[model samples]
Target chain A: MASTTEILEKILTSPPSAPQGIAYNYLVPNIRGLETMVKTLQVKGAQASGYPTPAASPQSEQSPTSTSASNSSEISLFAAATETFSQKNTNCSIAESLERCKPIMELAKQNNIRVRGYVSVALGCPYEGPDVDPHKVAEITATLLEMGCDEVSVADTTGMGTAPRTQKLLQTLKEAGILEEDLALHFHDTYGMALVNTVVGLEHGVRIFDSSVGGLGGCPYSNVATEDLIHLLHSLGCETGVDMVKMAEIGDWITKELNRPDDSRAGKATLARIKG
Target chain B: MASTTEILEKILTSPPSAPQGIAYNYLVPNIRGLETMVKTLQVKGAQASGYPTPAASPQSEQSPTSTSASNSSEISLFAAATETFSQKNTNCSIAESLERCKPIMELAKQNNIRVRGYVSVALGCPYEGPDVDPHKVAEITATLLEMGCDEVSVADTTGMGTAPRTQKLLQTLKEAGILEEDLALHFHDTYGMALVNTVVGLEHGVRIFDSSVGGLGGCPYSNVATEDLIHLLHSLGCETGVDMVKMAEIGDWITKELNRPDDSRAGKATLARIKG
Candidate 1:
């Protein structure tokens, strides 16, 4: 975690013609963490182009990691929509957490590295339950955007967000004039509503989504269920250049690696098609 | 499986007025099965009112189980939208199977017993894949409805259906002049697309949905994920008289009984609301 050697290696090795909006984000808690990133890269003789950041100097006292990378990998800071989540997650109150991120955001801004913000449990909280008011989410969102964070991803940490609450939260943000394209929906399939929420998000004009490989983290509702999401998206005529067959193949391999049930329907169905 | 003793007992004990479309459907494979049903009911001395039929003579010789409950529980017959699925599932071609249902539908009509139809893999097939033509599903649906089946439930058995495919299928049905009210959507959360498909189905004016309790049966795409569908529906101002709290409690109990992880988001969240 300290070195981020693995992440940097992947970033350095990534194809040049990768699609737009590609980001590698790390959860950088404090300025010291940022300084360590730069210091470690320097000690390892990493290049700036390896990071893709142009003017990113991790700390005032140290130099940037590399001069070649035009855009530094993004750093993400967190807050919560509810009191208990903030306390449990960040060990602070909601308002206090945002204030803390203000400095981190400024640091990233100065280094020419864009920071991403996450509002966890934006739809519902484990300790406080659902009904974390949409206004509270909107307020936190506005603050994150105000703090010069590139964008805020509102996370339904509890997987408790359904179409109604997700829409309500989005509506609240939209009414406050938050651009829909500026938002990304992060969902969990704890109860299998992730894709349903995806439809709602799409209807509300949200284009960005956060997802993982293989519905990992044991939540099947993550970002539309991998290839199945892409399949659904493809069916809706959204051309994601992501090769679904390859994605499903990866999903199959990883689920086996983890010894978890392969929950990807499109993956399984496509596999079945191949056999037939 | 033959006797409906427990089922009848439950029905008899059910509240005086239950919600519309509460069905206790039995899969009647053929005439022998139909005869056995009536003969068993007759031997049990089941009243006509209890059976909910006025005249359903088993095969012409046996007398109708007394002038039953004026609307006996319905029977469901299965067909498939794809040839491979039809052959694999029911051991016949799609056309041949619909041919098979024709007599059964006539028999039910004569007996004053309604029959429901199920079109499996209506959205996508495991063997044939996602390209199971919408026209085939529409044609089968039309045949079933024309055969006097009371309603047809389009099933995404492989759970490969996402919003786009589901919408396309529903659009095909609509183009074929099928009434949305006469249709039910039975989905599997194979890729967690059930609720997303539900949104599309709702948009197309189809209301009835098929789901499992506790999102039981290990399918992640149950509509009961968070009571959110209802929440989603209610936000659109559609009143669903379902008691969500009771539903969640029952959901919790069932998941515990099955020793399966409790996967209902609304069930868990709503319970949290109560405890908090």
Candidate 2:
């Protein structure tokens, strides 16, 4: 696990590579993690315009940090969509985990940092089979949004999402009066349905999705590949501000570094086209 | 590389395990291959159903075998959806390959044996990249269908299909007055988009798909796992007359035989579910 300083160092080093107006999110596990992130932002004092300075000393009392910024940085916390997942992953009930995130959300809000919530196992759980309920995901999303999360990313933690299931969940959320802009999608390629789930999400008017470059893990249960995701999005006439050729090259580079086969078929095919 | 007799032996042994009423298709590269298939069927007299006897000797001329079968079997041939792929793969132009298939199609029709056409690189070509034109795919599909092909399977030969591209190809076919039932989708999991492409096909009213048991090739260029595909289909409420449990077992068995990873996320997940 990265220490607070290391995380901050990477964040500091990250901006040049990220597009402008990008909101960097740090996953905060506790008050300390949240404070570290705020402290880092305060110390940097780089392009953090329109926000008041942090307290000279770390505030022990629960008080607003007295700042506002144009939606730049945020901290994220998560709750599981299924009871078994919540118990096993966080050693608590879903309610308890959401309770835990409550303070972190408030703390981040006071510091003018956006708070993003993630409902893990929104599609399925490893311990629980593929029948995770859409109502539960909707309820958790409501709770997160109610607690001041700027956005809630519904995560298919074990990638058991299918188009119909994904549609059901999104419909539940929509019926629960959740704004489309306030939601994002996180999918895994465990059953190779992430892209299909993504299509469902897009059809349901969702524009935000979570993916990593070449993704970070191997499948039957890993995150979606950014290269593959972006390629799909672009093919569907969605304008993503990503240079696919560059992204695919990086995917190739990183997969080679990790000594694993590249997972994205599109990435490999794209690279092959370039080579030819 | 298998002699005519060897191929027949496998088929004879295969039926008990295969789903009933399955229309087995053999890839025919030349007239000799077609003749071999017909001659074998005639010699066996086992489940030949309605097919007439073949010539005692392999016919040297282009005369169609005088026979009919109760949808017992069919033969398939392919042309690349892209010019470069056709040239590289078949050592001929797409039109030339189609011309070659024309006579084969005619011969199959005369024999009352079904002929299924496959347009490889229907989504993208290994050498030409992903901008393969939908119009070209439409023209080939029309010609193949016009040549009395029972159906045309659009093959994403390199698994380069994304949802939009897949939709585009289907739209072109639909616009060209090709009946939906006269289409099948063949996808490789090459960028892990096979299932996604399948979803697009389903949305477009195309039902049939091609999948293998275990992934025997590298990712981004292998057939989608049947277990994975069926699971997705089932989740989407497509009642495939497939026994997924048995399918998963075969997937496991074959992967073990190949000493490679079982790439079907649903296959492994389902087997785990069964064990638990």
Q: Alpha-carbon error at A226 in model 2, in Å?
A: 1.2
How far does residue A153 in candidate 2 sit from its true spot (Å)? Answer: 1.1
Candidate 2, residues B1-276: lDDT per residue as tens digits? 797557655664344322124477888987778877777666656654533333333453334432221226789988788888888788999889988887787778777888888988888876787789999999999999888888899988777788778888899889989989999999888767788788779889998888888766533477888898898889888799888888899899989987887878788777876786
lDDT of 2 at A21: 44
| A1-276: candidate 2 lDDT, tens digit per residue | 797668665655443322134476778877888777777777666644533333333453334432221236677898899888788778999989988998788888888887889998888777887789899999999999999998999999888777878888899999999999999999987666888888889989999999877777733466788988988898788999888999999999998998866767678767876786
Model 2 interface CAPRI class: medium
Give the worst 10-residue stretch by lDDT in candidate 1 chain A.
A61-70
CA RMSD, predictions in order: 8.6, 8.9
User: What is the i-RMS of every prediction?
Assistant: 3.7, 1.9
- Measured by TM-score, the strongest candidate is 2
Overall lDDT per candidate, in order of appearance: 0.72, 0.79
Q: Could you give the DockQ of candidate 1?
A: 0.31
